[model samples]
Target: MGNLKGVALSLLFTSFVLHLPFAESDWFINYHIHVTNDLPLLKSPPNQPNLFLHCKSKNKDLGERGMVKGQDYTWDTKVNFLRTTLFFCKARWVGHKTRSFDAFVTDRDEMPCRHYHNSCMWSVRDDGIYFSKNNATWGNVYPW
Candidate 1:
């Protein structure tokens, strides 16, 4: 009985140590948008098409809003969901024209977004869209 008790205690201690919170900052994903061109809101004039940013994960909208030129917006993951989750962001304007980018919670080489970092920035330019991870410079983000 004493041997069994010691084994149980050892197992408990091992489990505690393994499950302890990581010393480094927790993994997080952030979505940022920097609007550079004319992006009129829905409430804007009649002739101009309304422009907006939309982000979603597994059919759930994280944050979506009409964007303005020179304005920026960010949305950070609130909780850590161990499994891989794909988050998508889109730049859309009225008349059905849209450009999108996808980022995975898990590190994926094929994905445009990087993992285990701070934040990602999306730059909406007149010519094309781009993204930057952490403090890295912006790189072109192709439509999905």
Candidate 2:
């Protein structure tokens, strides 16, 4: 019983440490996803967190990692500000208002969707930001 208790305590400690948000790493956006097909040269907005993934459809998938529409995105790991673009558009037709917005992903276990079985895992490296998909598993970050 004592051995089991010790093992449990160690596991709990390890889990807690892993879940703790680490210091943001050095990362930046090299490019951005265009909000529309005709938006000439969509650059990353200035002075705001960059978006990682974006979509327009009510039911969308931002890679298998996460999804974003309007202003909601998932940041399940460390993210570099001024980098990454998650441009979302609500309309494909010309002259239509697009519910678009972008923001950097900096949190974990974020579910962009409330009814879907997807989760986000953000990571940072020399290149830029990267995210992965987990059905429910979290606390995992990856580099793009």
Candidate 3:
């Protein structure tokens, strides 16, 4: 009985140690967006015309503001560790009226950024948006 108990405890300790690396490597997905002036819309109005990128998960808002035309903005937040959490990103412009574009939805499990250097890039265009692990080619298409 003493030998059996010792064997069980040893197995348990080995299992815990084997999982340490995965536990310590908890990674956060970094999200990035580049908004371009496809259309020569005049600069935001003096009333502080609002143009920004909004990212939201189940319980957190990882949004950014003051997005200028032809500029890029990037931000990161803790990866959703709960039940399959759905997150979305959109470019919003608030002036006399409100307009949103290039809306996309993804979950941590489905985000390629998680596997590819923990980063993702998005290009916001008037027609739609495209995503890539690298910023060079627009491979994944997301509807506007």
**Leading candidate by lDDT:** 1
lDDT of 1 by residue, 9-121 (tens): 99998887678553223344343323333443445464443557777787578677765565665655522445355677777756547887664343432134334244555
Q: What is every candidate's alpha-carbon RMSD to the true fold?
A: 6.0, 15.5, 5.8
lDDT, residue 73, candidate 1: 55
Cα error of candidate 2 at position 20, Å: 1.4
Per-residue CA lDDT of candidate 2, range 1-144, in tens?
Answer: 999999999999889766655423223212222221212222443323233334432233555222222333333322344223243322221222323332223232223422234333333222333333432432212212
Q: On lDDT, who's better, 1 or 3?
A: 1
Kindly list the per-residue Cα lDDT of model 3 for residues 1-144, writing each as its tens digit: 999999999999889867653443454444443344232254645344245667666577766665555656665544344424455666665442233433323443335665456556666555555666555666537455
TM-score of each: 0.55, 0.20, 0.53
Clashing pairs in 3: none
Q: How many clashes does the backbone of model 2 have? A: 7
Candidate 3 RMSD to the real structure = 5.8
Candidate 3 lands at a TM-score of: 0.53
lDDT (0-100) at residue 37 of candidate 2? 23
Candidate 3, overall lDDT?
0.52
Give the candidate order by descending lDDT. 1, 3, 2
